[model samples]
Target: MSAATSRPRLVVGITGASGAIYGVRLLDRARALGVETHLVVTSAGVLNVHHEMGLGRAELEARADHHHSPGEVGACIASGSFSTEAMVIAPCSMKTLAAVAHGFGDNLLSRAADVTLKERRRLVLMVRETPFNLAHLRNMVAATEMGAIVFPPLPAFYHRPQSIDELVDETVERVLQISGIGQASPKAWAGL
Candidate 1:
């Protein structure tokens, strides 16, 4: 919990993946839920956000409570003593996944993930790639064995989502709940 507001601190990482919207939406939903978010967006992540959502770095960073550069290895989130509740890499790219899986702390994002894992905190990776190859599968298995949750952001049809926004919101809600962050109104399954 954050010392200032006593709110749960969540570390969010955005990579150069296809579904940049997931990261942005997650930040928005977390903020609405009163979660303190520390954002780390890679250069490619910024480019993808601009291309997919037309959001500049400033606009994207504005959605979070704290923003850290990818190169800032000395950021607060890089240390387990910083006391983050969890870390989520929304739309986690194959490259970033590999880095985390291999324990490579080359950038602030990966370093924060390493810290989260070392602290035994929840580390959720919303891997975005489809039709994964053998290498991707191995990395995912390794990360899972190392206690990271691999969430692929697959849309649930049981909720009967009417629009893309609904689907995204539901997925973000699930992510929040999985990260131990409270969901405002979770859509629970009711058997017919």
Candidate 2:
């Protein structure tokens, strides 16, 4: 049995944030569902994932079908014709959020996201900034207006996850839903 993705390419990225596990679980789950994944991690994302999720770059790299340097400007993903269905900046940082919202595309991740939005393809950003300021809220609104989903990693208590892994998985699942591949491995949820 294999994943049902038809030319289904998923672009997964990690940014500097506290919830690196969200990005990890999203990749893991995607792999289990047999999605061909392209991964890019910012330098800040590498440090943050080590400090927060305790996962090394090698581990993250292993989960991806193709790994592109965050700073590399020549990766295939920087262009729109690479045949990627969507891009998810899981645990999206404020910096990356602003970049994508404003179409900065300074880095490969942001550029890929920009391409996603411009092509009208799905782009899901799991924005993790709490105590949102006016600027953050406005960016979220702006990104949404530009056809991007700014997902905040707020967990629901209805499922009552027993451990941190479950909490992380819940958030990943929530974020994955917007990616169109979420239904492939959905767990039990309440209220249908």
- Best by TM-score, which number? 1
lDDT, candidate 1, residue 19? Answer: 93
Superposed Cα RMSD, model 2:
2.8
lDDT of 2 by residue, 96-185 (tens): 989988999888989989988988889998888789999999899999999998778877778777987787787777666678774554
| Best prediction by lDDT | 1
Clash tally for model 1? 0
| lDDT of every predicted structure (CA atoms) | 0.94, 0.83
Please provide, for model 1 over 25-103, each residue's C-alpha lDDT reduced to its tens digit, 9 standing for 90 to 100. Answer: 9999999889899999999999999999999999999999999999999999988779878999998999999999999
Candidate 2 has an lDDT of 0.83
lDDT of 2 at 30: 83
Off by over 4 Å in 2: 1-7, 187-192
The pairs that clash in candidate 1 are none
